[model samples]
Target: MGRKEFYWYYKLHATTAIFPTRSDGKLSKYKHLGKAGSQTYIDAIEQITARTRIEALDRSIEALRQGLKDLVEETSKYNKE
Candidate 1:
């Protein structure tokens, strides 16, 4: 059997992403996923906070549908006037 290893991605500052090397200043072999403001990073965090990606996506889709429905109703009411 083999074990999977994980590394920590700490944002030293708000601008860039860097692998914090040790006192020897050596970067680890871990791959960088994505930057903070990028869509990948946002989705990853959302999935972590929510039960699952499907649930998070469902919530967003439902909100959009409701907003569209409201806009249609408002437009129809205005047209009726």
Candidate 2:
């Protein structure tokens, strides 16, 4: 069989029989879709990328806030001198 056919065959047979509950109480079925070319794998990669971008932006905002606070403190000290 070709690679695509093999992937579908594997996916069909690799699924688990049990549906487990997630932390939010939603029922989720387990699928063995960790194969590199699958849609689910691609989605997971995108999610990770988005999360990383968000974290970097948050750090930048915090650094800017700290810089502003330091500038204000310096201004107040100079005015009092």
Candidate 3:
């Protein structure tokens, strides 16, 4: 999801779950599902980190390919002599 969508969804669920209403239509005190909420945030962060790592890895692989191509061309030139 995009930036705005993410914030909306996070706020929506947080509000609904933390402030559930009573039978008489009274809103209860906000209760945090502490560890679970923490875990959710941790998991989201890990996902973002994983994406960053993957992109970095892809760039490194491309760099390696270019370096290897240069090396191979140099070796071929030496063999031609």
Number of the top candidate by TM-score?
Answer: 2
C-alpha TM-score for every candidate? 0.37, 0.61, 0.49
lDDT per residue (tens digit) for residues 1-81 in model 2: 556545331222315544344456554555345678678667766866999999999999999999999999999999999
| lDDT at 52, model 3 | 99
Which tens-of-lDDT digit does each residue in 1-81 have in candidate 1?
776876445232323334545576665544244567667567656755776767889999999999999999999999999
Q: What tens digits encode model 3's per-residue C-alpha lDDT throughout 6-74?
A: 222232234344455545655555433334357755675576699999999999999999999999999
Q: Give the lowest summed-lDDT range of ten residues in model 3.
A: 6-15
- Between 1 and 3, whose lDDT is larger? 1
Candidates in order: C-alpha RMSD to true structure: 11.1, 7.9, 13.4
Instruction: Give residue 72's lDDT in candidate 1 (0 to 100).
Output: 100
Candidate 3, superposed: residue stretches over 4 Å from native: 1-37
Question: Over all chains combined, what TM-score does candidate 3 have?
Answer: 0.49
Flag clash pairs in model 3.
none
Best by lDDT: 2
For each candidate, the alpha-carbon lDDT, in order, equals: 0.66, 0.68, 0.65
